[model samples]
Target: MRIRKKRSLLNQAAGGDGLRRVVRKAYGVFRREGLAGIKTRIAWLRAGAPGTVDPRRYGEWVRCFDQIDDATRAVIRERVANFENPPRISVVMPVYNPNPQWLAQAIESIRAQLYPHWELCIADDVSTDPAIRPLLDRHASADARIKVAFREKNGHISAASNTALGLATGAWVALFDHDDVLPEHALYCVADAIQRNPEIRMIYSDEDKIDESGKRREPYFKCDWNPDLFLSQNMFSHLGVFQKDLLDEVGGFREGYEGSQDYDLALRCAERAGGGAIHHIPRVLYHWRVHAESTASGTDAKPYAVVAGERALNDHLDRTGIRGTAEFELNGYRVRYALPDPAPLVSLIIPTRNEPELVRECIKSIVDKTTYRNFEIIVVDSGSGDPATLGSIASLEHDEVVRVLRDDRPFNFSAWCNSAIEASNGDIVGLIDNGIEVITPGWLSEMVSIALQPGVGAVGAKVLYPNDTVQHAGFALGLLGMAGRVHHHLPRGSFGYFGRASLRCTVSAVSAACMIVRKSVYRDTAGLNEKDTSMAFSDVDFCIRVREAGYRNVWTPYAELYHHESATRRDDSDLAMQARFDKEVQYMRTRWGSLLRDDPFYSPNLTFDEENFGLAWPPRVGALV
Candidate 1:
């Protein structure tokens, strides 16, 4: 019945004339592998999970922002004229048996660039297609900027890419594919980013897929430089431009990673990005041609790509000295960083009121299920009046691992957490809500491992509701003013927007309901805010402070827990509570100022109206420049 319902959803989602073939294939998956298989299969078939977005929304967005009128082109021309000494950008392409039409289009896109400072360096890997050489020659003859080299031997993509690299004389190199089409302003944007940030070592832009009919869709409007997210999947694959010196230092793309050679190269470059040398342009600069054979169409087309990506990530993990295991799952990689030898004692603090069952569930789940051995629990009871709740608290006081702190203060969550934090002596401190029940036994192991990372400030678990729907994957700024629930209500095990829900990536914030951080980090940030955001938005404020203190706040789905609290059905009807909530929202608006509006973890192209990565009706980006 679940399989039938999922198939129905897939069939319904696979609407429009273009996805009919995918729907037919999806039925086969339902018969063979059941619900999980069909879910993953449909994702490949649809190119992405079917979010609550109109299918033609990307097309509309492109028409509004990507398309350039004569007036806009004139403006771009004038801006180009005012540019400084622009560095020569070498657009390197490795050709090997590409479609005649696509190869032609790719070359034409380079020639059509608005910026005139780029050189197209093409290396053919002994194409068996008889007509390929003439086409390359024709383009090479047509434009002096276009350089072509016919390889004597049939070297793979990595070898061919190095050959193209050998031909580059420019200080900056842009990795271009033989078949993908670049926008007219693609090189212009790269050049613009380079000129603006002279110290920038690498730059990449958002990209989309183009089918055989030239219609574009699946625009991946990505966020700024996210090192953790990059480790999960190659977010910097399209319009990937790197300073030649960095490439020379890193020794470019490696062999045997043909399909994900670019991913490998980016991972290598990232190690030396010097914290802020990488940049992301929030625009679709490249159009990945999707066909039966292209990876843009599906990962199954080249299963070796997934294997290569897994190996590449592992290679990176090994090089970086991170004690972790990388495994490929759901078209992305999951890295389980090992807990340090003699795992540091973790202090779990839970603040509860009159809820006895919720408290018992949270405590028992942890006591029974948590695999991380060295941990102590502190339950901060703030005026529990119910007899049953008091009895439950009295029973817990006798437990060796658990301690009760009685705080009869007016319900200030920050005060309770801070009070408990002060009383704890563990290296790592966990802020668990009374209603948060452990779903996975290794939840503490995952959180503690991530928290111990020197650069990480806070680690959050994948929080789910009672019915197994996502309560909070992570929190982002400017969503519903202060804190927005990311991937809210998405089903368990589903990939949300290129693995946003599933991937262990950095975010603006995580819910304190199931968050962990080093005690030192808590001390560094002065703990949660109690004065302004005493009750609400304190976690968000604390996270912001943590990030500002030069630490990344990460959210991972591997650490799963059930948030049994009625977060969605909060009845803040009291006049004082409502007034306090309003004040907290205003406090964030003033305290953070521009930071709230410009969350680096989220794209400006995305809407703040909701947290689902929806297209902003009028995107926050300025007119094409």
Candidate 2:
């Protein structure tokens, strides 16, 4: 390693050949370690911190080729063939003027599948390239399982995909791009998943990008059946297998949504499949080929694709009766839901005591910056003995929107919040910290829009620290005994863990600090446990209970705020406070033990020790129940 670095430095000093060598070496590291590894190496080269190239894993994703030895192939083949009910999967391909070499590889991938109970259904989309039809025909003639259909007219991807779907005679249909390659065990894995869960109607696997040189990179480790994540973007683009019945129900793919025809179909299929009916195989089954003309290379290759994606999302929202406008942003769709008719008033319940200046700033921001008009501020004053704080509360009583509720009892955060909820006339309740400063406009509106959604129980905003690092982006369970904030200290706009920090998605919990929940949902869970967790884990407990009551908790980066509180500077000196904290932590473990052990939205493959979505040292696997 020392010699390599010395050589790298010597190469850096020299011109042309030496520099190219250094670059190639760096690129080699990049290919092995991915973007995070490359970033670490760059930092080290820049004389930065001690973050060096991460030690390579024994059987990491890129080493998939090596892992698929003859022994592994034999095991897969045996497992697949031994399955009692092996569902026939029809591999559907919509061919265009793809590179002949790449197209051949794609076809061969299907041919090389370990699971033999499959057929290849090819639909030629009237490609002007004379070579495409003949190539497809020769392959079809050679293989009995391969079926070819030539389109009379030039239809786009949507029509072509539909034609291919029509040709499928299998129980399930697997989508395959013309230029993409599938792993040999891909069909076997899908079959195994179906065998394990007979109810599974839709299945998707993790995928990576393969460049022109056939080097795999940019592996996307996706979560299982995340509805909110799916709404944000089509996470399941490759190796998507759906039951033929579900495909027929959704009518394959829509004709006009050419670029995002698959996305449209997936959305429709999901609506029918339900969240539980979909299965995710956490393996790199598909390799999307990246070429100059491919969307995988860049969205700029086909800008119309972006427009089509937005249209698909909008149409999905409309069809699902969700009042929202989906806009194309950050290579994904951001849906800004329309406010309900005669917009239900939201009660901004803030608990504070003797912090006049802070309360004043908080109130001022709410009045000045809040875009949503229908809101009432309910300040749950906790025995404010100071004249300044009392006077501040008194002054706020004049405004029709502001209402001061005095609670001279013991300082119980959970109790205060519960009391405020009871007092609130509005349908929605917002539990905001006194120290939070509104950073984004329409913050309340965004929260309310999501909160009002049919099954959403609680909505949390992206809370950044004063230094602009993330304080909270929804709370993840099992991080610190009870829960920890997702992307806790990630820099602003960094898009931590596959854009999870930025996108509005489902989570097990969201922090009470700047959290919004429906009044009815709060009552359903009997609000927070004031006695057990007055200061800590109350919000986590409440959110979990809300989820347990069959509602989803959402966290949105759109509604941004700056949390003034520093979690690091927390004073544990007071023995009583420490004891209370310990008790609260214990209470959380006792109440929601299983939930704390596993968070569905946050994949188990991800690390819990660190907030960043780093690879788990020893990934957890479920025992056969």
The prediction achieving the highest lDDT against the true structure is 1
* TM-score result, candidate 1: 0.91
- Evaluated against the true structure, the overall lDDT of model 1 is 0.83
Question: What digit string (tens of lDDT, one per residue) describes model 1 on residues 302-332?
Answer: 6567667878999988988999988665557
* Candidate 2 CA-lDDT value: 0.79
Number of clashing pairs, model 2? Answer: 0
Error of 2 at 489 (Å): 2.2
Residue 417 shift from truth in candidate 1, angstroms: 0.4
lDDT (tens digit, per residue) of candidate 2 on 1-625: 1335434433433333556755675675455344644563443334311211132442363463324678777777777767897899999999989999999999999998889999999999899998998899899989999999999998989888888888999999999999999988889888888898999999998777788988766666677777888888788788899999999887788987877788888988888778889898777789999887887865555656766787888888888888878865443567888887889989999888877677778888889877688999998888889787699788988988999999997758898889988999999989999888987657898899899988999999988898978888988788755687778887765656656766788888888888998899989999988888788778888888898899999999878788876221224887888888898878877878888877777666567787766655555544211
Residue 236 of model 2 has an lDDT of 77
User: Candidate 2: which stretches are off by over 4 Å?
Assistant: 1-66, 566-570, 622-625
